[model samples]
Target chain A: MRPVADVLIVLALALVAASSTAAVLARDPVRQSTVLALLGLSLALLFAVLQAPDVALSQLAVGSALTPLMLLLSVRKVRRKGKEGGSHRNAGNRTGSTDQEGRR
Target chain B: MNGWLSAAALLLLVGFAPTVWGAASGPVRRRVMAQNLATLAGCLVLLLLAQGYARPSYVDLALVLAVLGPAGTLVYARLLADELAERPARDPVARALGRAMTPLAAVCVPLVVLPLCVATGPGRAMVKLLAIGALLIGGNIVSTRALSARHATGHTPRGTGHTPQATGPERHTTGGQSGAAGG
Candidate 1:
């Protein structure tokens, strides 16, 4: 059982870590945010394995519920702002440099 | 008890960092959501540890943190939205405030943690409360500044659907703007 728990914990940590990396590397904010949600889910699983039931419950409830809702709200706001450089040629150039240099 | 809780707390902090930083170039709505989700997960971890320890008081504290974290993020987002719609260009006052708050907030973490060493019974609650208060207040102030900048600059829009054609090479600065445009 201890070994199983350890493996689970390691797996959970790996998943969360990978998703977090993806979240940072992802250029699309929407995709990044979604990946973040996945990271949160992995964290909750970690807590559950660590034997914190109440903590796991709160993680599921708040992490799964409120956070994503807020992200969606922000996404809507961005979409409403409309496409910045509407034309194709400029848009491609804009997003490309924006993604490359913008990433730290 | 301290060991497990501390580890859990550290994990929570680690999870929060990426989500927070991701807001700059990532989706605002999604980042906020991720922020809330991360907070919730952290809170849940805290709550679980508290339960195992049979500490109801800690549970209450976790509840407060969970609710406040997302609500605060939402308020900050709304503020960002309003700011973005109209350019409010950052002035000396805002910059000065950011500079002042950043260092002061950094120092508070140790102060918040110090109380835990001797924390016992009700005193422990005080320690936890102070720590939580610092985090919540600090997060609010910082996020508000960021939102103001984003609004002033029209950077950090939330959509991920930008086709390459819609983006420009000089959009790098714009990218910087979007990253910071959250509440």
Candidate 2:
């Protein structure tokens, strides 16, 4: 019983480590949020293996759902802002350069 | 050491590892699909763990996961509508996964939950387990339907004609409609 439990704990720990690393290394913010959710799931499993049901429950709520949702929302906001800003800057640059040429 | 623990461990290796890999590096569609799969796998693992540890109370964890997992996937499907529209998940692997999602849920729920119910016998606990299983299968079906529906709608307008001007608003309208339906 002890040996099997130890094996389960180790497997879960490995999953946690791999997922956390993947989350950090992910290039796209959207992909990162996805990986982060998986990371949360793995961590909750690890906590469960460690006999910490209370922690696992909270982790399940926050890590799996809340954190990823937050991350994805923020990413969406930033991308929208960036798109608007880029178009605005391009317009400003074009107009400003033409105005300077006319004055010159 | 126990059969339950061994089962959990086996599932961890077989069921979850690929999902982690799939979620980590893939197209957004695949990643989202993988994340959904991870949640399902995670919920099952919790159930097995509860049995392994001889703590029925721990089933609550699975219950919470069962409820929350599909909600998260729906959130992704809703929020990432534009992205999903821009690039349809037409890749063979994504299509295969999307096709498999429902059948997998249908099969796995029974495979895992029946044994659990047998172990638990006829009681409130057994009922709770059955409820979780139902929720899991139902959630999986809804989410997969949402995903495939979104994919179909996202692709149709563009496929019919390549006019960017024509498809842009059309795509948005379709995406909006699907989002409403999914929500």
Candidate 3:
């Protein structure tokens, strides 16, 4: 039993290491969010193997779902803002150029 | 070193590892699909662990995962709708996975749950085990449908206005209905 538990723990820890690395290495925020969710799932499994069910439950909720959801929502909001900002800047430049012509 | 523990270990190596790889490096559609698969695998591992440790209380982790897994996938599907639409998952691997989802769940849920049910014998615990199995399958189907290209293309045209919001609620209601039936 001890050996089996050890095996599970080691395997889970390896998964955590690999997933965390992958999450960090992922370039796209969207992809990173997905990898981050996998990291949470692996972490929860590790907690379960370590005989901490309560911690596993909370980790599952916050790590797997909540964290990724927040990340993705932030990415969406930022992208939209960037798009609007670019267009607004273009419009402002256009108006400035026309005003300079009018003054001349 | 019980059989349940050994099985869980094997699943962690075989079922879960590939999902980690899949999610780590792939197209957005495949990564999302892999994330969904990881949740299913995670839920099953928790179930096996619950039985392996002889602590029925641990089953709640699996139960919670059963509910939250698909919901998380749905969030990805909704929020990443534009990306998914721009580059649809038309690859053979993604298509194969989408096609295999139902059959895989159909085989796995019973193969894992039936033995656990027998080991547990007939009781509330057994019923709860069964409910988790049902949720696992239902959620898999719902999320697979939600992630498929056809669904993305169908919803992408009306991406603005209330269409995205409406589709999210509509899918949620369908998931709720499935949960009701499963429970």
Candidate 4:
């Protein structure tokens, strides 16, 4: 980098790049949410260094808290749904033969 | 880069890299702590960057982070409580991690914020910086307490904190799942 700002910006970019790569590689949404939060932090810093406070502010709000909360909520809801589905499937199997006889 | 920017760069290099690595590769419990550490480190970096760039307005970014970072962690602790609770206390690593890192963060975050407060000087911005510092530190305390409470109850099983966690599923509910992970 030619100067300090350029160097800081580059560092922020590197932080973003590294964490984003990790986020992509992570299959677990829980882990991915953590990495994504780190990515958001670096991105916000990048924006702030680049003189985009407005962008940084919005990014901070969404990235630091909102995105992770959303991801965790969805993960919880999905897990709960899976459990419910499993129970329903077991119930269906128990009545499978009776239902077949009724159809005949 | 000047001293401030240099410090920012150094913090990014030394501090955040490990948090990213920890958050990325570890078990969910470890990842949550790493994520919290990232917020603390990220705030310090932003504060340094603001001072380095002489853009007091840039502190807004840090302020927002201070407010949201722990808030995010608490959200994870709340939502992930069930999943996390299922994991039992056998993993010494996670327990050690919780024990070691909590004090480190409690001390380190404010250590970083204090100088930024001094450098920021006496003004509305200084007051804002102090408020941000207070929020960041205060939020970290509450969330850390919440995390410890969850772990103490979930892991210890016989601990006093267990009853409330059981009775309340909405706010601070914790389960006892041991099959998942210690990272």
Query: Which residue pairs clash within candidate 3?
Result: none
Candidate 2: regions farther than 4 A off: A87-104, B160-183
Predictions: Cα RMSD each? 15.5, 7.7, 8.3, 9.3
- Write one digit per residue (lDDT tens) for candidate 3, span B1-183: 299999999999998988999899877878888988899888999999999999999999999999999999999988988656655455566667777876787788889999999999999999999999998998887787778744546445445545666567656765675565455
Local error of candidate 3 at B61, Å? 0.3
lDDT of 1 by residue, A23-90 (tens): 67877644554565556566665666566656766765665446656776776556555555354543
Q: Which regions of candidate 4 deviate over 4 angstroms? A: A87-104, B88-97, B158-183
Writing each residue's lDDT as its tens digit, candidate 4 over A64-96 gives: 889988888897777668768775543553377
True contacts kept of each: 0.00, 0.78, 0.72, 0.77
Cα lDDT tens digits for candidate 2, B51-120: 9999999999999999899888988888887656555675666778888987898898789999999988
Q: Where does model 1 exceed 4 Å of error? A: A1-30, A37-41, A52-104, B1-28, B52-120, B155-183
Best lDDT among the predictions, by candidate number: 3
Candidate with more favorable, higher DockQ: 1 or 4: 4
For each candidate, report its DockQ versus the true two-chain complex.
0.03, 0.42, 0.39, 0.39
CAPRI classification of candidate 3? acceptable
Q: Which candidate would rank higher by lDDT, 1 or 4?
A: 4
